[model samples]
Target chain A: MKRLSRLALAAALMLALAVPVSAQVSDGVVKIGVLNDMSGVYSDLCGPGSVEAVKMAVEDFGGKVLGKPIEVVSADHQNKADIGANVANKWIDVDKVDVIVDLPNTAVCLAVQKICQDKNRINLISTGASVILTNKNCSPTGFHWTYDNYALGKGTGTAMVKEGGDTWFFLTADYAFGHDLEKSTAEAVTKSGGTVKGSVRHPFPCNDFSSFLLQAQASKAKVIGLANAGGDTINAVKQAAEFGIVQAGQRLAGLLVFISDIHSLGLKTAQGLVVTTGFYWDQNDETRAWSKKWSARMNGRMPTMAQAGCYSATMHYLKAVQAAGSDEAKAVAKKMREIPVNDFFAKNGKVREDGRMVHDMLLAQVKKPEDSKYAWDYYKILRVIPGDEAYKPISETECPYLLEKK
Target chain B: MFELIGIPPQALFGQMLLGLINGAFYAVLSLGLALIFGLLNVINFTHGAQYMLGAYVAWLLLNFLGINYWLALVLAPVVVGAFGILLERLMLRKLYHLDHLYGLLLTFGLALIIEGVFRNLYGISGQSYPVPPVLTGGYNLGFMFLPLYRGWVVFVSLVVCLGTWLVIEKTKLGSYLRAGTENPTLVQAFGINVPRMITLTYGFGVGLAALAGVLAAPIYQVKPTMGADMIIVVFAVVVIGGMGSIMGSVVTGFMLGLLEGLTKVFYPEASNTVIFVVMAVVLLIKPAGLFGKAS
Candidate 1:
């Protein structure tokens, strides 16, 4: 009886140690949670479209990662930081979500980033624009995928300054992201030899930009840099046209513009507006073919950069998981940095130590009404900014990882 | 020619004119609220939603029917006001005899449902409405270039406000309407159809909101939340102006717009909250409001 009991105990211990090799995923199912502005100003840019993109990636990756079934779940943050954090907490702790993606609003993105880091979950940011995500609050498991404020500001500012829009007045939104965008754009403007005339601050989600636009017109700057996004940018641009700010010879630079915005503003009002973008659907065969497929599912609405980023990021992360042979957050994150990202959205993209995925961006001018030949044809690509030029240099990164290394 | 605190005179005047233009919107929106509250006493929380519907109707007319802006300006109000009539007849009428909270709750829920339906139909980035050719150019005021559309907005607002004020303050029908709302049974005994007057009054007020929406379509993105954003500020203006006073809402609306505009220039950060500050101050000093008659 003593010999038989000892033999059973030894067999049970061996089985426990051997189980990990077969089941690398902790929860047996790899869950991905997409949290974004599902019903706010940015809904069109990164809301349900983002969810579909991630699901598409999962399906394209065979609906499984590391021999475990992959599941996609999404929720509306409603543009509130607290709600985003609550959802992120529940997703990570309760649902055992392996990764979170597509956080758009700056406050919400930053909040979720902190929560994900604490919970040891991967945070893949495809939409939020603040440079602080990579600089001040970089996490080992967090990846800033699509674009940042610095990328947008520098790309558009340098292009505009070269077009003889050397003097600029800014219509800035009053918020963390807005101020960051203004600062980044201002730095870029100065770096590129453009002198900022002055600036006016408007409330976020503002409907009437008449007061602010009047100030901009009075400044007599050669160019007006609208350092705002979504609805605020749309209204400012629309009102600027009404005030004849464009016709009077002053150019307007939409610092952060989405194809969705151009669609809303139409060609007549949005024409000739200089913009910087990470992805344009109709860029080339790969992008056009991919976007055509995606748009077919989206009721023919082309994928915005953030939505496309969601697809690309999800695909890359899945590939990394497949390579690492695990869904563990740290292992997958490490594997993600090791493998180079080559997708339709990002070409030869490399994830730096600061967690910024350096990728090529496009500088384009909105096409004239007559220049637009077909539906959803908006941009006339001015130039391609190589990945290094679009994103911030590693030398300038204040990410704690590099600082601790120093 | 003197500047107010570091802002140049040109900037100040430009801001004032711009503020007045915004004030035109506030005045029109609050005026509608005042008309409804004065007679119907329904506290139409859906005023903002109706205003949004007005813009959508105008957009639909232009897009689907190939209608021009001028005809839409006339037709949208009628259509949206007709919608308002449906709300009153079907739902709002039952709650009219209840507490103010009941009516407020019903209208608030209706507003959300309306906004949600629109949000579902249109994905919320919003649609654009172009300025007509007639309203395209601007007069080069030395201090600022005033858009022809803006000038037209102010002009239309004044005409509408004045027309409503005249009908309510000077007409025999207006007196009958007022008396009917004051004492419905007495007014009924006097051989007047008081119920029909109240119903038409509610429609007229809602029509006014839709009219403002049409005027706003070109300047702002015609989105579902446009009315929602403006309604809170307009409510503050109505409260400050005296809830049921037509002239009170009109004057306070314009005044607050100018104040907000000035705030944008001097202290831009507080512009959105400055109106609420004024409202708070007014509430502290005189709970009845600046132009409110003691009930």
Candidate 2:
């Protein structure tokens, strides 16, 4: 019996030794999770297109890092904070995922950020617009990519106010996104010596806006600022046209809009409406080239700002992991912050210590019906706000991560 | 004291007009929901999706069939109602003998399937429908501009709601429906086809929802999610009105819409949640709701 036990022990030891060290050393494969609002308002921004963007980045990086193949997986968080946290925890603890990317909704992004901090994993937030991700709730492992509410509001509001369409009235959505946008745009309007006469907060997904439009008309503000996004924005704009609010000498400023929203509104309704963002398909030669490739791959849906950010952030994460020679979350995260992320979307963008990725923002105006020489011709680039001017001052953010010593 | 917080006359009257417009939609949709639930005993969670389907049908008719709004206004509801009948015959009829909750579950599943397919195909972005040439412009009231289309929706929905009420309350078919609801087996013995009545009742209810959708398409974007958001508020409206009387649902839907408009003027922060708060208060005071029958 003693001889048999010794032989069994030897056999087990030899079997363990025969297994490749790469599997045990975390060098065989790196796994990343992409979680976002897959079927809600932000779906177009980061749904299937986002997953494809991440996959493309992996392919661009040769699909391997540190002698290991890289793998990508994704889930739809459905815009719920609890659901997002659950997915993040499962990705980290069960699947042993090293990174999570492209969380869209602000509440969900904040909740998932806490989970990443606890698990010591990296989270690349590309679709969310709240500044708080890089503010009070910032974590060393969380990186805020793409545009946030402050950048969009300031970029669009200041430019429009400077153009002498100063008196403003807001038709805002009733949510965190709308609140933040209204606050930021209000500040910009006030800062530029423009008066905010009044504002109306509409219920989200409200199908009719006659009452709100009536209030806007009564306010008689020169610029009717729309501090809403997605379907709400389109509905508000369309109703405004029906009410003849635009022809009544009031301008509509779409503080945050995507190409998809413009498509829904059509050129006639959306024409001359000014908005601001960090990405547009027709802005530059590089963007157009990348968009053409992506459109072909995505069956002709143009890449939104969130999708572009996903591509840039995923490429950067893989490159960092390759440079670090390990899938250890802390080491790879530190390398990511140190490296300047370069892409077709944003040139020489740097991830700040507070986890905010600083990039140049753009202002674009909706093209008129006659301006459209082809399909998908939505916006014409108005101006590019430099990186320093686009974002809030670093001192303004209350992130603890930025306060900590390097 | 009322005037201090009171809406301006122009604003009040304008908002009330706006309220009526919103109430028209609420009245039509809730009426449909109440009717379907009354006989079919299914919540028809896909009611909103069906409404969206109505709008998309109108859009497709215009785009593909070269049918104008007038034609679409007639055809869209038929198309959507037929689809509703198909849904009932295929899936909903199977759950009648089970607990009422099963009916709710089945319809909810159908809702998910319909919404999922639409989201996958068209995405969340809205599609615009042109205002018919006749209702394109607005009439300038001294206080506010009133779009002709808004006025039309309110008028048409009122006529439709009353017409439906008349048919259900006065007609022989409606009496048989009422009898069948009271005693299905007895009604069958009385030489009435109870099951077919239930099926047609569901179809009628779905047709009402589709008509509302057709009316709404020009005013709102033809989006996949248009129905999902509206349905929740309509549920709140149903709870507040108690869904006991056809006229009660219609009246309450308009009243609450005006109240919401007033809230937008006075306390903008609570505008989104005001209806829900009213619902909670109503539940606390009268569990059966203002017009609802007590279980």
Candidate 3:
């Protein structure tokens, strides 16, 4: 009877040992979590569209790395920091996701940044524009992809100033992202020898901007730099058009404009607006082909820059995983910086030591209603600012990781 | 160089005008809430969703049936009001005898369902409704440009608020409503169809919210979440106005809107919270509310 009990205990131990071995070999799946604002104000920019974009990247990468199947999962942050952190923890612990991508809001991005640092998982931020992501809060596991507010401000601010828009007024959203945008753009305006006449900070998610536009109009500034994103930018621009601020000969510079915002405003109202973008779907044949595939799955809505960046970032991460021959976060991240990111979205894109993805950004103006020949044909590219000239210089970076190494 | 308190007058007046337009919306929405609360004793938490429905209905009419803005102004309210009537008979009426909290909770659940359905149908990115051709441009008022559509919104909202006030305060039907609100049992003893009156009153209150929604469509993006954002502030306005009289909501809505506007000019940071701050103060100093009668 004692010998029978010992044999039974040995079988139980074998079952426990066999489960995780199969999990690591037969179905060694690599999971990527797309944590974003799936159902909120920023959904149109990076919600379900981004998820599909990442999936396309996986398919294009042949769907397996080191003989392991790649799977995609998603969760909505609901634009809350605490909820984002909780989702991050679950994705890292319970789901064993190797990478998290496409976080749009700054508050949620910062929250997830800390969690990724704690877990040593790769965080590929595709939509967040806060400069602090690469500055004070930089982490070894975090990569600020697409564009940041500093780059956006530089792209649009320099262009506007060169066009003789020497005087400026800013209508800023009152939040961390907004504050960073205004500061960065203001610095760019000053560097270009332009003077800032005045500025006002309006509450975020503000329904009305009539008063703020009037203040910009009253400032008599040559350009009104709108340092906001998503719906805030659309509303301010729509109201600025209504108030005849643009008709009065002042330019409206959307520092962080997206294709989604232009679509929301329609070309008629958004026409003549100067903005900067990391990718325009119709910019080239490769982009058009990829965007066609994206739009087919996205219900005919073209991919925004943020969504496109998701595809590029995910594809590159998978490539690095294969190159490193492991799904380890530190190994994949180090390989990410070592390789050049070449995809339909970004060509020759280089990830910096500070985890800032350096790529060429475009300066585009909204096509006039009559100028637009087809649907979703909104931008007329004015110039291409090279990757080196677009992003903030590395010497100026305040990332503690970089600073400590130096 | 024309400045007020170190700020330009154009900025000040522009914000105030915007504030007044916002006030117009507040007055209309709060007026509906107050009317429903007075007759039904339910908080009508679905007010925001109902308001959103009004805009969606107008958008559908224009897109699908080629209905113009004027027709939608009349038609949207009627359609939404009919929905409200059906809801009252089938659902809300069942909760009439229960606690007021139950009514609030049930309507709140209804609100989530309504918002969820809309969100599923048409994501959160709002659909744009253009300003009517006739009211497309604005006249320069020297200090600031006043868009014609905005002026129309303010004017129509005032007329509607006043019209609702006169109907409730002066007319014979208004007398029935007031009597029913005061003592429903006594009013029923006087040979009136009290249940039918309650149903119609709920419909009328809902219709008022739809009307405001139609007015707001052109100014704000016609989105599912639009009403959700505005309704919370309107509740604060209703609380401050105290649901005491029909006109109280109108007066307080406009006054607070203007106050919020002035706050934006003086202290832009507090513009969003100023209304709630006032609510807290009012709650502390006068729990009965400014216009509310002591229970």
Q: Between which residue pairs do clashes occur in model 3?
A: none
Off by over 4 Å in 2: A1-27, A404-406, B1-6, B178-192, B242-244, B277-295
> Any idea how many clashes model 3 has?
0
Give the TM-score (0 to 1) of chain B in model 1: 0.98
- The weakest ten consecutive residues by lDDT in model 2 chain B span B1-10
Q: Give the Å error, residue A244, model 1.
A: 0.7
Q: Which pairs of residues collide in model 2?
A: B242-B292
> Could you list the chain B TM-scores for each candidate?
0.98, 0.95, 0.98
Global fold similarity of model 2 (TM-score): 0.91
The lowest-lDDT stretch of 10 consecutive residues in candidate 3 chain A is A19-28
Clashing residue pairs, backbone N/CA/C < 3 A, model 1: none
Better of 2 and 3 by DockQ: 2
Q: By lDDT, is 1 or 3 better? A: 1
Query: Which of the two candidates, 2 or 3, achieves a greater TM-score against the reference?
Result: 3
Model 1 bad stretches (over 4 Å) = A1-19
Better of 1 and 3 by TM-score: 1
As a whole number from 0 to 100, the lDDT of residue B106 in candidate 2 is: 82
- lDDT per residue, candidate 2, B32-146, as tens digits? 8888877777777888888888898999899888899999888999989999898889988998999989988887787778877888888888678999999889798886788
Candidate that beats the other on lDDT, 2 or 3, i.e. the better one: 3
lDDT of 1 by residue, B126-197 (tens): 999888888888898898989999999999999999998998889999888778768889999999987778
